[model samples]
Target: MDLTPESNQDDEAVGDLSFDPKGALDAGDGAVLTRLARAVEAVDPVPDDLVERSLFAITLAGLEADLMEAVYLDTPLAGVRGAAAAARADDTAPAEAKTITFTHDSLTVMISLSPAAGGRVRIDGWAAPAAGLDVELHRPGVDVVTVASDEDGRFAFDSVERGRASLVVRRTDGGGGAVSTPVIEL
Candidate 1:
């Protein structure tokens, strides 16, 4: 006799969900899993924006917004980027004062770095199309700092300790999405 119970032809009720264990994997299941694993391994595992999102999450203090593109001082660093720096024997060290620019679709921010007393750094920043905005300074292992920009879109962080840092700018009027700059060495 068959072990399975015969269903009533006249029954109209729906079948109950089965809770019984399906038991351990068999050779067929293992083969399917192996094929799936191989297929996954054939493609790149990491997402292209993983690094950008992770950095934004950690450095931007959990700000949800678009990331601004960093415009390296290309004109200023042309020599450093090329063999010109290597050819120069007089001043081989990187410049003490560095300028960086970050831009988004709606905003543009420029910052200047200068040395301060006690081996600290001073950051002077200016945003274009002068408007009310809040600027946040982020450094690893340190509290996030938020500052307000002046009418001229000028802001400054005085006597900041030297380290890697990032800047996040947001509109004070809450008009648009926030934007962040890539972390850079101070």
Candidate 2:
């Protein structure tokens, strides 16, 4: 029971000789890990498409609850053939209708935006694999307008103010997750 430094020394000498488990990474260990990461990155760099998809997925994760994931497929404006000058001229011309598509696991939503009277845009939308769902149009600082899809899975929002907007499709029965499209400019 006489606890002395010499006794403690003797106990430790005969006790487990294993070294203390490493806790935090030391500078050299961290350097080695950094080198390893660099080597891996060099050997197989991340794909550009994969990174884009990952960011898209992250955005979907932050979306409203009960909303299904939808990926932006394409916009007609993206395919317009013109240089900067031509594009500027085109912008000055009468605004023509443009189509955009968003895809979900179960359905595809397509919408055409056309300029209407009173400086508003008309949104006509269709959903493939048709279902009687309600489509809601969302715009910042504006009241949400909702319309039920016809038997043909077609819906329309008239007199939508020009600006950024998005869409959400939900089953009338509220049985499944709602589908949301990315915000787009009209």
Best candidate per TM-score, number?
1
Question: For residue 168, what is the lDDT in candidate 1?
Answer: 83
Per residue, candidate 2 scores C-alpha lDDT tens digits across 1-186 of: 685655455554644533322346667777889999999999998743345434543454454634444443443345411222233345555766767677777778888777677767788988987889899877666777889999889999888776556687887877668878765556
Q: TM-scores, in order shown?
A: 0.59, 0.56
In candidate 2, position 177 carries an lDDT of 80
Measured on C-alpha atoms, candidate 2 has an lDDT of: 0.67
> RMSD in angstroms, candidate 1?
12.7
**What ranges in model 1 sit over 4 Å off?**
1-61, 73-95
The best candidate by lDDT is: 1
Q: Write out the backbone clash pairs for model 1.
A: none
Check candidate 2 and list the clashing pairs: 68-178
- Cα deviation of 19, candidate 2, in Å: 41
Each model's C-alpha lDDT? 0.73, 0.67
